[model samples]
Target: MQIYWTKINKIIEETPEVKTFLLDCPEGYTWEEGAHIHLALEGFNAGDKPNRRLIRHMSISTLPNENSIGITTRIKEQCSEFKAILRNLDVGDEMAIFKTHSNVPLKREDKNVYLLSSGVGLATFRPLVLDYFERADNVNKIHSLNVDSSKDFLFTNIFESAPDKKFASQFVDNRKDYYEEVKNLAADKDGLFYVVGSDEFLVQNIEVLLEQGIKPDQIMLDKHARQLPEFLSSDLSI
Candidate 1:
């Protein structure tokens, strides 16, 4: 599918380091719960050959029924050159948006779904939480965890306001002491786990989950990395 330019409807400052862009899609593009779309600025870094056109894959955080698609991103000045472009985006600015991509499509099963995310990783797992809660049967079976610094706990209200909010857990790991709780959570062994986060974060969580007897087939992952070993790789539509 060809990439198209869409207008930016709004920019939400969730925290000092996190921003969510609400994009206007007149074509009515629809995507699955954990899907993501590529975004690029037209002619970003025009003259620089090596970095002239870099498209970033951003997860669609909003539910499919929403009027607009949204991408919540964490801004790190040292790691991204395109952040300047994103931060400067205005309400009416047009950005290049590619088609949606996802390998971990939403599926219902007898087993419960447990989602684990960290920092901006919430972008990928958020829609799943919202969609699952809409189903009366899934109300008590779904659980979630968000690990981040105390100040970086963005979008707390969204999960806290859910009908069965007790299933949602937010553990602030300011000192990296969250391992014990993480290990205990995954010991259920029968739960299906969906993980999204940085490479180190994903590795640590997956290792702990596996050590606690979770099978490889019971887990799905989307880590922020350019490449991973085939053993650790899953079908990432992005």
Candidate 2:
């Protein structure tokens, strides 16, 4: 993947710990929903070995509107270089951006679409929601369930305002209501289901859905990181 330099235009804290980043992509660049861009720090100072830090992948959280790409990051207590770079980034300062890629192409025309996401996983669904609302001929009804770990929920306002009845439910797992909320959504028939989240979130919810009689073929699971177990991989592939 080719990495290009992008400048951070602004950063806003959506929740206490989650922050949204607005980046100024180079002219003519565009991306689709569920696509991700890899970010890296710039300008390593003396004795600052090139921080070949793990490639941080962030979903294209918002649509490409007004020539900017939006990404949301969850701040961790360990204080990583990735977080540091994001924290210190200023307008006109450059950060690297690899072009977007995804494991599955979005099927916007699916009449009954079920979108499942947790925490930063909601980032992956942002563009999809935007696309669904933007088209004149789009006929799909979107059911989006967002799970957050109590303190780190992002963009609650956006999800709450979605016009579709199916898209309005948001889940906060701190109280254990996540499963029930997802169960209700999965009970619907003939919907194309897409799940994006941590491995545990995907696995547990997919299991719940299957237990509730959702066919395996109708569900698509995308893990945010590479820590997924083999059993889950096999299940997703089935």
TM-score of each: 0.85, 0.82
| Local distance difference test scores for all models | 0.72, 0.70
Candidate 2: worst-modelled 10 consecutive residues by lDDT:
223-232
lDDT by residue (1-238, candidate 1, tens digit) is: 7767889999999988889999886585778888888887867436645244467878889886887888899876665667877888899998887757775555576676777878788778778777776663533466677778745786776666443443555655552656666676787778888778876777777677777777767777763333344325432211
Superposed by TM-score, candidate 2 places the C-alpha of residue 185 at a distance from the truth, in angstroms, of 1.5
For candidate 1, the C-alpha RMSD (Å) to the true structure equals 4.4
* lDDT winner: 1
Task: For residues 86-115, write the lDDT of model 2, one tens digit per residue.
Answer: 666666777777747765346756568878
* Cα misplacement distance, residue 231 of candidate 2 (Å): 6.1
